[model samples]
Target: MNLSEQHRDRTDIPNADWESHMRRLRPILDLLKEKDRTLGEWYLKGETAQEALQHRAYDGKAPAKTAIEALSKEYGRKNKDDPKTVGIWNGIRSDQIGASLSLEIDGGEIFPKSLEISLNEKNERRGSRLGDYRSVAEVLSEVVRTYDSFYVTYGPFFYYTNKVFDDRPGVSWMLYLPHVLTSSEVPEARALIPVTRDGKQQGTIIVSVTDEVFDVNNRTHVKAANDIEIRLADQDLLPRYIDL
Candidate 1:
């Protein structure tokens, strides 16, 4: 039959009507208390599931001081070292949502032999001359560690990158920030290059923390580091993910 006729006929047939069809399937959506084994263990054992979840959710603002006491009642203190408990704790940490930067640095110079000469039989030679060197290497390294410490307190750090894409852009690193902050607040990434006594390239080097470019799911991960590259086209790059 025609489309309209087919629809009309189906409605007329009560058993075939959409309402009746849905009614038969409504029980599937009912909120039944399925025995969630995970929850059961926590509740029955009087474990710290609720407290742990709360702490993780609120960044350890209020911890469950009595969780171990309650959990010990059922699982006992020995079982507190159980893998299941550890897994639960890790899961809580993973669920903590926050933003962070992947900071990295590179560049700097390496020197080989400084001066090698022999004074014999009325022969004299001069040593190697000093070259231009960036004086900010030590200061920059300290800055990177400082920023890294600040972020680690809030969440875990991750590194990522792709060599193929990076070659075209030359040597570069990035710092990713969370959406909670604005780009203007985070300046362009920068570092002071160090010069070695031996002849070697010396300048502000870009260091990257992201070793692997692809994610576990094989998807290309993007970060604020990429944005920093875009923002700072050709200026004296400053630290990108700084608070000030």
Candidate 2:
């Protein structure tokens, strides 16, 4: 299987100050930059970096830093006429890398706050060596370490394999939870990988099915993932399975 192809890795953290969210974006932006330097430039819907260049947000050539600083100011502003409309909705992407980072900065929603980083199949095949559970788990662990993310899911895009959650892990290759849980909390077939940050065990990463990189086409792998999902639900570990 092409382990990294069509991968979607999402992470969720509780809502916090806007500054905290900007701080969280730094490392993630850095990670994307490692994939494609030009992807560091941030932009809003219906706007382009070249078009935004003349705007005050550019503030020099450092796209990532300046754009986030500009977004912070934007987040703090309010519209007297429509207070609900006063929010930030922006993202960073690169056509060259075929990867993008999308953020949900609105706080009025019922869902846990989250962000998603997606890599198209072509880019994944060329740039990523995520052929096993350990490699993909490490990538997810990086986000957890940077954001202290309480929840994360990494797997191929649902459309790529015609897989859906359906009250199970179905398409997800791995799930990360900040709270510690024993192996007894998961299915016998699953692997509970411990994620450490700053020398402390920050959370547990539940690998779906097997150590082999998850293949959505593999019925065994999909069922193994679903099995772990059911077990986690039984232990009340998955309060909101689909956060992003």
TM-score of 2: 0.63
lDDT agreement with native, every candidate: 0.23, 0.53
Model 2 misplaced stretches (Cα beyond 4 Å): 1-20, 32-96, 106-111, 122-131, 159-171, 209-211, 241-244
Per-prediction TM-score:
0.17, 0.63
lDDT of 1 by residue, 135-238 (tens): 11232222222222211100012222432233223122322221122324334333223322235322223323233321212223333344444453334233
The Cα error of candidate 2 at residue 86, in Å, is: 14
**Clashes (candidate 2):** 0
For all predictions, the C-alpha RMSD in Å is 28.1, 6.7
What is the C-alpha local distance difference test score of candidate 1?
0.23
